[model samples]
Target chain A: MKIALDAMGGDFAPQAAVAGAVLAAQQLAGKAQVVLIGTEEAVRPLLQEYGPAAATLELVPSTQVIEMGEHPAKAFQQKPDSSIAVGYRLLHSGTVEAFCSAGNTGAMLVGAMFTVKAVPGVLRPAIANFVPKLDGGMGIMLDVGANADCKPEMLEQFGELGSLYAQYVLGIARPKVGLMSLGEEEGKGSAVTQAAHQLLKVNPHVHFIGNLEGRDLFNDKADVIVCDGFTGNVILKMAESMYDIMVTRQLDDEFFARVNYETIGGSPILGINDNAIIGHGVSTPRAICNMLMQGYQMAYAGIVDQIKDSFKS
Target chain B: MKIALDAMGGDFAPQAAVAGAVLAAQQLAGKAQVVLIGTEEAVRPLLQEYGPAAATLELVPSTQVIEMGEHPAKAFQQKPDSSIAVGYRLLHSGTVEAFCSAGNTGAMLVGAMFTVKAVPGVLRPAIANFVPKLDGGMGIMLDVGANADCKPEMLEQFGELGSLYAQYVLGIARPKVGLMSLGEEEGKGSAVTQAAHQLLKVNPHVHFIGNLEGRDLFNDKADVIVCDGFTGNVILKMAESMYDIMVTRQLDDEFFARVNYETIGGSPILGINDNAIIGHGVSTPRAICNMLMQGYQMAYAGIVDQIKDSFKS
Candidate 1:
C-alpha cells in the first residue's frame, strides 16, 4: 500500500514535508510505503538531506505548486500538474491508499470534490477534527469547514460519517454520536440542528446520544459530535486559540496540551471516496508525521468503504 | 437609581441573593440602592442573617417564584407576582433603574419582552456576555442565548447593540464591532452572516471591523463581536467548560481563571428599554454581588437611554 504526501504543501514545505515523510516511511516500512509529490527541483535537495532514510521515500514529480492564497477551485483546475492536483490524481487512481497535505486547505478540499468525489449515497463530505477528551482518549467532530452552510440532511450525514471515523479509525467500539446545539434539550437549537437531531436519533447506524451543548465537547457525553461546518469551524478555531494561549502562557497541563493542533495533526475529509487529511498550514515535521500516521490508520481501517456500506441504502 | 434583584433566584437563592444584595448595598451605598424582591417568607429570613448591613437593602416582596423548569412565557404570565415578574414590573414602572436575576433565564427573557420591551428600531433583544480579553480588559459578544436563530438585520442590530454596550457600560471608546463568522473575509460565513457582514459594514452606528473567527473572541481584534444566539451560546458554553477543566486540573493561570462565569458574573439583556442582567444558575454570593454591581454600572451609565437615543430615528 502507498500513502502519499504533498511535499510542496505547507509553510515549511519540501523541508518539513520531506523530513516528515521520511519519518513516516521509517515507521510504516513493513506496513505501507510513503510517497511524496512535488517539483523534483524542490524535493530532491530536501530528500538528499535525509540520506539513506530518503531512500525509503518515493518522490513523484510535479511542475507546479498551488500557493496558499490561490483560489482553490481555479488553481486545482488550471494547474493540473500542481502538487495538490497531482496528489488528488494519485488518490483517484488508487495509486495511494491515503493522501495528506499541510498546504492550501481550500485547494485540498476542492481537490477532493473534483477528484475522488463524495460517497455514492452521501449528501456531502465533512472535515472531521479530533477532540481531546478530558478523561483521556479522543473524540471526533465533523463539518469543521467543509460545508459552512449545511442542510439538515447534511448534518445527519455528518453524524454518520464522524461516527464511522471514530469506530473504524479511532477504534471506538460503538461511538456515541451527538448533535452540537445551544442547549441539551431536543428542541433547544436552530431549526436545522433540531431537525438533524430527529434524523440522527432514528438513524440505526449510530449510537445517537442526543443533543450536546458546547460544554459537552470535552466530556464523556459523546465520542462523535456532529455540527454544520460553520459551527464546527468556530469550535475548532476557538479550541486552537485556547491551546495557543496556553502555549503563550507556558502552562503545560496534560489535557490542555492535547488541545494543540500538532497533537491531533490534521482533520480528515470524511464521507469521500478515499482517505484524505488536511493538515494545519504551519504544521511542523512532527505534525506532518502524525497526519501521515492518521492517514495510514484511516486507510488501514478501510473507513471509506465502511462509509459507502453504511450509506448504501 | 434602584437596582433590583430576585431574592428567590439562583440555586442557592434567598441566602446567596440576600448576601449578594447586602454586599452590593454596602458597595453602592452613596451612589445607588439595592432592592430585593421575593416572597417575604423566603427573603426576610435570609436578609435577617445579614444583620444591620441588610438594613441598607430595600426589600420588595413578591408572592411567587419561577422555577428553573417552568415555561418562560407561561410562568411569567401565570405567576404575575413571581420574583422575576415583579422585578420586571419595578423596572418598567420606573421604580428601579435595572433588574438582575439568577433564576429562570427563560422567565427573565419572557418578562423583558412583556415589560420593558425591545427598544424601538431594535429588531430583537440580545443577551450580551463579556469576554475577558487577554490584554487585561473586557470585550463583549451578543445574542448569547436570547434568539437561537437571527436574521441578517438582527445580526446587524446585534453589532450596534454590542458596540453600544462596550462603549457605555464597558467604557471603551469607539468599540470595534466584528461579525463572527467561519472566516475573516467579507464573503466567508453562512448566508445570514455574510448578509449581516454587509449590513454591519454599511451601518454608520458602529466601528465595523469586518468578520471575525471564533479564535478572535478573547483577542483585541473586536471590542464587540456580533453573532447569532446559537453560535454565541456555543462559544460561551465552550469557554465555561475550558475554565472548568482548568479548575479540575488545578491550573491556576490568571487568564484562564477569568473565563469563569463568576468572574464576569452575568450576561445583560441588550437592546431593551431597561437594563436587565441574567446571572449563572449556580451563582455564588460573590457572583450575585458582581452582577448587582454590574446592574449598578449599567444603570449609572444610563445605557438604556443611550440605546433609546441611538435608535430614536
Candidate 2:
C-alpha cells in the first residue's frame, strides 16, 4: 500500500514535507510505502540530503503549485499539474491508498469534492477534527468547516459520518453521538439544532445521547459531537486559541499538550469516497509524520468503505 | 440608588444571597443601597447572623420562589410574588434602580421581558457576559442564551448594544464591535451573519470592525463581539468549562483565574428598560456579591438610558 503527501504544501514545504515523508517511511517500513508529489527541482535536493533514509520514499513529479491565496475552485481547475491535483489523480486511479496535504485547505476540500467525490448516499462530506477528552480518550467533532450553513438533514448525516469514523477508525464501541447546543435539554437550541436533535434521537444508525453543550466537548458524554460547520469551525479555532494561550503562558499540562494541533496531525474530510486528510498550514515535520501515519491508519481501516456501507443501508 | 437581589434565587440562596448583599451594601454605603427580596423566614435569620455587618442591608418580603427547573413563563405568571418577580416589579416601579437574580434563568428573562420590558425600538433583549481578555482589560459578549435564533437586524442591534455597554459601563473608548464568524473575511460566515455584517458595516452607532474568528475572542481584536445567541451561549459555556478544568487540575494561572464566574458575578440583560442581571445558578457569596456590585455600576452608569437613547434615534 502507498500513502501520498503533497511535498510542496504548507509554509515550510519541500524541507518539512520531505523530512516528514522520511519519518513516516521509517515507521511504516514493513507496512506501507510513502509517496511525495512535488516539483523535482525543489524535492530532489532535499531527498539527497536524507540519502538512504529517503530511499523508501517515492517521488511523483508535479510542475505546478497551488498558491494558498488563489481561489480554491479556480486554482484546482487551472493547476491540473499541481501537487494537490496530481495527488488526487493518483488516489482516484488506485495508485495510492490515501492522499494527505498541509497545503491550501480550500483547495484540498475542493479536490476532495471534485475528485474522490462524496460517498453515494452522503449529502455532503464533513471535516472531522479530534477532541482530546479529559479521560485521555479521543472524540470526533464534525462539519468543522465543510458546510458552514447546514440543514437539519445535513447535521443528522454528520452524526452518522462521525459515528462510523469513531467506530471504525477510533475503535469506540457503540459510540454515542451528541448534538451541540446551548442547553442539554431537548427543547433548548436554535431551530436547526432542535430539528436535528429529533432526527438523531430516532435514527437507528447512532446511539444518540441527546443535546450536548459546548462544555461537553472534552467530557465522556459522547464520542461523536455533531453541529453545523459554522459552529464547529468557531469551536475548533477557539480551542486552538486556548491551547495557544496556554503555551504562551508557559502553563504546561498533559491534557492541554494533547490539544496542540500537531499531535492530531490533520482533520479528515469525512464522507468522501476515499481517504484524504488536511493538515495545518504551519505543520512541522512531526505533525506531517503524524498526518501521514493517520492517513495510513484510515486507509488500512478502510473507513471510506465503512461510510459507503453505512450510507447505503 | 437602590439595587435589589433575589435572596431565594440560586442553589445556595438565602445564606449566599444575604451574605453577598451585605458585602455589596458595605461597598455601596454612601453611594447606593442593597435590597434583598425573599421569604422573610428564609432570609431574616441569615441576616441576623451577620449582626452589624448586615445592618445596612434592607429586606423586602417575597412570598414565592422560582425553582431552577420550573417552566419560566408559566411560573412567572402563576407566582407573581416570587423573589424574581418581586425584584422585577421593584425595578419596574422605580423602587430599585436595578434587579438581579441567580434563580431560574428562564424566569429571570421572562420577568425582564414582561416587566421592565424591551427598550423602545429594541427588536429583542440580549444577555451580555464579560470575557476576560488576555490583556488586563475585559470585554463583553452578548445574547449568550437569549434568542437562540436571531435575525440580521437583531445582530446589528446587538453590536450597537454591546458597544454602548463597553463604552459607558466598561469605560472602553470607541469600543470596537466585531461580528463573530467562521473567518475574518467579510464574505465569510452563515447567511444571517453575512447579511448582519453588511448592516453593521454602515451602522453609525458603532465602530464596526471586520469579522472575528473564535481564536480572536481573548485577543485585543474587538472590545465587543456580536454573535447569535446559540453561538454566544456555546462559547460562554465552553469557556466556563475550560476554567473548571483548569481549577480541577489546580494549575494556578492568574489569567485563567480571571475566567472564574465569581469574578464577573453575572450576565446583564441588555436592551431592557431597566438594569437586570442574571447570576450563575451555583452562585457563591463571592459571585453574588460581584453581581450586586455590577448592578450598582450599571445603575450608576445609566446604561439602560443610554441604550434607550441610541435606539430612539
Candidate 3:
C-alpha cells in the first residue's frame, strides 16, 4: 500500500513533510510505501538532506502549490496540479491507498467530496479527532469542524462513524458511543441533540451510552462522543487552548502534555470512499510522521470497506 | 437594597446557604440586607450556629423545596411557595433587589423568565459566567444555557447585555464584545454565527471586535464574548472540566487555582427585569458567599435599569 503525503502543505512546508515521509518510510518499510507529493525542485533538496531514509521514500512531483489562505473549493478547481489536488487524484485513481495533508482544511474536504466521494448510503462524511482520556486511554470525537451545521440524522451517523473508528483503529471493543450534550439527562439538549439521542438510542450498530456532558470530555465515560460540528469544534479548540495555556504558564504535568497536537498528529476523514487524514497547519516533523503513520494505519485497517459494509447492512 | 438567598438549595444546603448569608450580611453591613428564603425549621438551626452575624439576617419562610432533579418549569409552577419561587415573588414585588440560589438551575431560569420577566426591548434573556483569563483578568461570556436556540437578533442583543455586565458589574470600560465563532473570518461559522457577526459588527451600541474563536476564550482579546446557548454552554462546561481535570491531577498552578468556581461564584441572568444569580449545585460555603456578594454587586450596579435604558434608546 502507498500513502501520499502533501509536501507543499502546512507552515513548515517541504522540509517537515519530507523529513516526516523519510521517517514514515523507515518505520513502515515492508508494511507501506510513503509517497511525497509536491514540486520536484522543492522536495528533492529536503529528501537529499534527510540522507539514507530518503532511499525508502518515493517522490511524486506536482507543479502547483495551494496557498494556506486560499479558498479551498476555488484553489482545488484552479490548481489541478497542486499537491493537495494531485494527492487526491492519486487516491481516486488507486495510485495510493490514502492521502494526507496539513494544508487548507477546506481544500482537503472539498477534494475528498469531489474526488473520492462519500461511501454509499452515508449521509455526510465526517472528520474525527482523538480526545486524550485521564484513564491512560484515548477516545474519538467526530465532526470537529467538517459540518458546522448538521441535522439529527447526521449526528446519528456520526455516532456510527465514531464507533467504527474507535473499534477498528483505537481497538476499543464494543466502544461506548455517547451524544455530546449540555446535560446528562435524556431530553437535555438542543432540538438536534434530543432528536439525535432518540436515533442513536435505537440504532443497533452502536453501543449507545446515553448523553455525556462537557465534564465527561476527558474522562473514561465514553469511547466515542458525537456532536454537531459547531459544538465539537468549540470543544476541540478549547481543549487545544487549554494545552496552550498550560505550556505558557510552564505547568509541567503528564495529562496536559498529552493534550499536545503533536501527540495525536492528524484526524481521519471517515465515511469517505478512500482514506484522507488532516494534520495541524503548524505540525512539527514528528507530527507529520505521526500523520503519515496514521494514514498508513487507516488504509491498512481497510476502514473504507468496513464503513461501506456497515452502511450497507 | 435587599438580596434574597435560597436556603433550601445546593447539596450542603441550609448549612452552606445560611453560613454564606451570614458572611454576606456581615461583609455588606449597611450596604445591603440578606434574606434567607426556606422553611423556618431547616434554616433557623444553621443561622443560629452562625451566631452574631445570623442576627442581622432576615428569614422569609416558605413551605416547599424544589429538589435538584425535579423538572424546572413544572417544579416552579407546582411548588409556588418553594424557596426559588418565593425568592422570585419577593424580587417581583420589589421586596428584594436581587435573588440568588445554588438550587436547580432550570428552576431559577424559569422563575427569572416567568416572574421578573425580560427587560423591555430585550429579545431574549441570557445567563453569563466568568472566564478566568491568562492575564490575571476576568472576561464574561453570555447565553451559557439560557436559550438552546437563538436568532441573529438575539445574539446581537447578547452582545449588548454581556458588554453592559462587563462595563458596569465587572468594571471594564467600553468592553470589547466579540461574536463567538469557529474562525476569525466573517464567513467562517454556521449560518447563525455568520449572521450574528454581521449584526454585532454594525450595531453602534457595542464595541464589536469581529469574530473570536475558542482559543480567544481565555485570552485578553475580548472582554465579553457572545454566543448562542448551545455553543456557550459547551465552552463554559469545558472550561469548568479543565479546572476539574487540573484539580484531580493536583497541578497546583496559579492559573489553575483561579479557575476555581469558588473564586467566580455564580453567573447572573442578564437582560431580565431583576438581578438573578445561579450558583453551582455542589457549591461550598465559600462559593455561596461569593454568589451572595455577586448578587449585591449586581443590585448595587443597578444593571437592570441600565439595560432597560440602553435598550429603550
Candidate 4:
C-alpha cells in the first residue's frame, strides 16, 4: 500500500513532514510506502539530514504551497500543484491508497469533497477524532467540525459512519454508538438531537446506546459518540485546551499525556469515497508519523469500501 | 440581606445545606442572613450539630422534595411545598433577597421562570459558570444549559448578561465579551453564531472581542465568552470531566487543583428577576458554602437591578 503525505502542510512542514514520512516508512516497512509531495528542493535536504530511514521515502515534487491561512476551497482550486492538491490528485487517480495533510483543513475538506466526492447515500461527510478513554482505550467521536449545523438525518448518518469507522478502523468488534447530548435521557437535548435519537435508535447498522452526556466523554460509556459539528468541535477544542493547560502547568500523567493530539496524529474525514486524514497544523515529527500510520491502517483496513457496503445494505 | 437555601435539595441534602448555611452565616455576619427551607425535622438537628455558627440561620419548613429525576416544570407545580419551590416563593414574595439550590436543575429553572420571571426585555435567561483561567483569574461563560437552542438575539443578550456578571459579580471593570465559535475569525461559526457575532460587534454595551475558539476557555483571552446553551453546556461538562479525570489520575497541580467546582461554588441563573445560584447536585458542604457565598455576592452587588437597568436602556 502507498500513502501520500502533504509535505507543505503544518507549521513545521517540509522538515516535520519529511521526518514523519521517513519514520512511517521505517515503521511500516515491507507493509507500506510513503509518497512525500512538496517542493523537491525544500524536502531533499531534510530527507538527507534524516539519514538511512529516509530510503523508503518517494518524493513527488509539487511547486505550489498552501499557506495555513489560505481559503481552503479557493486554494485547492487555484493551487493545483500544491502538496495538498497534488496529494489529493494522486489518491483520486488511484496512485496512492490514502492522502494525509496537516495543512489548511478547509482546503483538505474541500479537496476531499470535490475530488473523490462523498459516498453514495451519505448526507454529508464527517470528521472524527478519538477521545482518549480513561480505561486505557479510545472512543471515536464524529462531526468534530465538519457540518456545524446538522439536521436529524445528518446526525443519524454520523452514527452509522462513526460506528463503521470504529469497527473497521479502530477494531472495535461491536462499536456502541451514542448521541452526544446535554442529558442522558431520551427526551433531553435540542429538537435536532431528540429527532436524531429517534432515528438512530432504530438504525440497524449502528448499535445505538441512547444519549451520552459530556461526563461520559473520556469514560467507557460509548465506543462512538455522534454530535453536531458545532458541539463536537467545541468539545474537541476544549479537550485539546485541557491537555494544553495540563502541559503548561506541568501536570504530567499517563492519561493526560495521551490526551495530546500528537498521540492520535489526525482525524479522518469519514463518508468520503477515498481516505483522507487531517492533522493539527502544529503537528510535530511524531504527530506526522502517527498520522501517516493512521492513513496506512485505514487504507489497509479498506474502511471506505466497508462503509459503502454498509450504506448499500 | 437575606438569602434562601433549598435545604432539601441535592444528593447530600439537608446535611450539606445546613452545614453550608452555618458556614455562610458565620462568613456573612451582619452583612446577610440565610433562610434554609426544608423539613424542620431533617434540618434542625444538623444545624444544632454545627453550634454557634448557625445563629444567623432562619429555618422555613418545606413539606416536599423534588427528586433529581422528576420533570422540572411539572415538579415545580406539583410540589409547591418542595424546598426548591418554597425557596422560589421566598424570593418571589421578597422574603429573601436571593434563592439557591443544588437540586433538579430543570426544577430550579422552572421555578425561576414561573416565580421571579425573566427580566423585562430579556429574550431568555442564561446560566453563567465561572471558568478558572490559567492567569489565576476567572472568566464567565453563559447559557451553560438553560436554552439549548438559542436565537442570535438571545446569544447577543447572553453576551451582555455575561459581561455585566463579570463586571459586577466577578469585579472585572470592563469585561471583554467573546462569542465562542469553532474558529476565531468573524465568519467562522454556525449560522446562529455568525448572526450573533454581527450583533455583538456593534453592541456598544459589551466589549465585544470578535470570536474566541474553544482553546481560549482556560486562557485569559476574554472575560466573558457567550454561546448557545447547548454548546456552552457541553463545554462546561467537558471541562468538569477534565477536572474529574485529573483528580482520578492524582495529577495534582496548582492549576488543575483550581479546576475544582468547589472553588467557584455554583453558577448563577442570569437574566432572571432575582439572583439564583445553582450548585452541582453532588456538592459537598464546602461547595454549598461557596454557592451561598456566591448568592450573597450577587444580591449584595445588586446585579439583578443593574441588569434590569441595562436592558431598559
- For model 2, residues B51-139, the per-residue Cα lDDT tens digits are 99998889999999989999999999999999998999999999999998999999999999998899999999999998999889999
Worst 10 residues of 2 chain A by lDDT: A304-313
Maximum-DockQ candidate: 1
Q: What CAPRI grade goes to candidate 4? A: high
True contacts kept of each: 0.88, 0.83, 0.66, 0.71
lDDT of 4 at A192: 95
Backbone Cα, N, C clashes tallied per candidate: 0, 0, 0, 0
Name the lDDT of candidate 4: 0.90
Candidate 4, B1-313: lDDT as tens digits: 8998999888998788788778788888888888999998898888788777786788999899999999889988998899998998889888999898999999999988999999999999999898888888999999899988999999999999999989998899999999999999997999999999999999999999889888999888999999888888888888888888877777778876677888888989999999898999998888999999999999988999999999995
Query: What are the C-alpha RMSDs, in order, of all predicted structures?
Result: 0.9, 0.8, 1.2, 1.1
Better candidate number, 2 or 3, judged by TM-score: 2
Q: Report the poorest 10 consecutive residues by lDDT, candidate 1 chain B.
A: B42-51
DockQ of 3: 0.78
TM-score of chain A of 4: 0.99
- What's the CA error at residue B153 for candidate 2, in Å? 0.7
Candidate 1 per-residue lDDT over residues A21-110, each given as its tens digit: 988888898999999999999999888887898898998999999999888899999999999999999999999999999989999999
Q: lDDT of candidate 2? A: 0.94
Off by over 4 Å in 3: none
Candidate lDDT (C-alpha), each: 0.92, 0.94, 0.91, 0.90
Model 3 Cα lDDT, one tens digit per residue, A1-313: 8999999999999888888788788889899999989998999888888778688788898999999999999999999999999999999999999999999999999999999999988999998999999899999999899998999999999999999988888888899999998889998888889999999999999999999888889899999989988888888888999899888878888987888888898988999999999999998889999999999888888878889999995
